[model samples]
Target: MNLALVFESGDYVLIGVFLVMVLMSVVTWSVVILRIIKLYQAKQGNTAAKQAVMESASLEEAAKKVQGMTAPIGTLTADAIAAYRNYRNTEAKTLAEALPLNEYLVSQIRSSMSRSMRQFDGGMTSLASIGATAPFIGLFGTVWGIYHALINISQSGQMSIAAVAGPIGEALVATAAGLFVAIPAVLAYNFLNRSNKTIKQDLDAFAHDLHVRLLNQKD
Candidate 1:
């Protein structure tokens, strides 16, 4: 069928649906690529932060290594060091005398991890909404195409390959387009969500080690 025939009836709705699908596709890809990059950087930064802490002779040296660092692991380590120092410096107490210092450091580290998880999960809700609604939106276009074809058939009293194919083809394309937009969205959401869970586990583990290291920090 010629493409012109598909546009003969009320195709504005189809065009609108196509535009929406295109918009959804663009946003979905943008989120997927950006989040993947962020997760990778966080993972690398976490490794670098762990190495810096383990190799340093003192917590102060570790803090220097992570100074000005912006990654989640780096930030958490830096914050813990700061919290420990603030507690000792303010109370004029040595590390041995800072009884609640461990608890305070753990609380601060947990807060940082919570913030990191939230950051990692940014834009997930939008991805989910796109996945959940794209197919229905596409289906709406298909139903309209079929309805438009039926209206033409009823008006002209004809049903030939040429007469029926244009609308049916357009409807099928609409349905396929819907699935096309939705499939990637659903996959990305699931994959990224799983990656985030793994990242949170890593962060929690780092926090435990950091707390122990801070407790052993020297003056």
Candidate 2:
């Protein structure tokens, strides 16, 4: 008659819907928590690394300061320095090395940026997929629940409002559950996306400055 009773009397399909929603919710929160921690650490480390690079007198000094750093800036600076060293040290230059030093450094830094960005991109696709699909899955459950409710009413020959309302209301819970699962996923997706965009801007700026500094140091 009530929500509990509806669930208690529900068949496998209804229970399956509930289970699926629960799983989605668990996955969503797990990703949200892990990503928050990751981005926070990355942002903090990157800030420090950027400061170190900005304050340093030369690329070699910056490399020494940021050595073993896991953040994007560290990766970019390390890769740039390594490439520059290799370009200078190589006795026989390959065809790829035929490119101007600036162009070659730009290419290497871009690759490093991509690698760093990939670390932040983990779980984003899953969040997006859940945000897009959860509502529909819940709606399907609601429809199925209503079908079950109507079947029970027909068998009981119950046409009264109370009898109809209880099961129908119970069925509506599926839709509510769907929204409950989806809203958080969608919100998290947007929030994390914005956070990543900010980090990307920082990476782009750092890359340009790093390139320019490398060029200047070369000269």
> Best candidate per lDDT, number?
2
Task: Please list the Cα RMSD from the true structure of every candidate, rounded to 1 decimal place.
Answer: 3.3, 1.5
Candidate 2 Cα misplacement greater than 4 A, ranges: 1-3
TM per candidate: 0.89, 0.95
RMSD of 2: 1.5
Residue 18, model 1: lDDT of: 79
Task: Give me candidate 2's TM-score against the actual structure.
Answer: 0.95
TM-score of 1: 0.89
Cα shift from native, residue 157, model 2 (Å): 1.1
lDDT values for all models: 0.84, 0.88
lDDT of 2 by residue, 46-117 (tens): 999999988998767988999999988888889999988887778798887778888888888888898999
What is the lDDT for 133 in model 2? Answer: 88
Show where candidate 1 strays beyond 4 Å. Answer: 1-10, 92-99
Worst-scoring 10-residue span by lDDT in model 2: 1-10
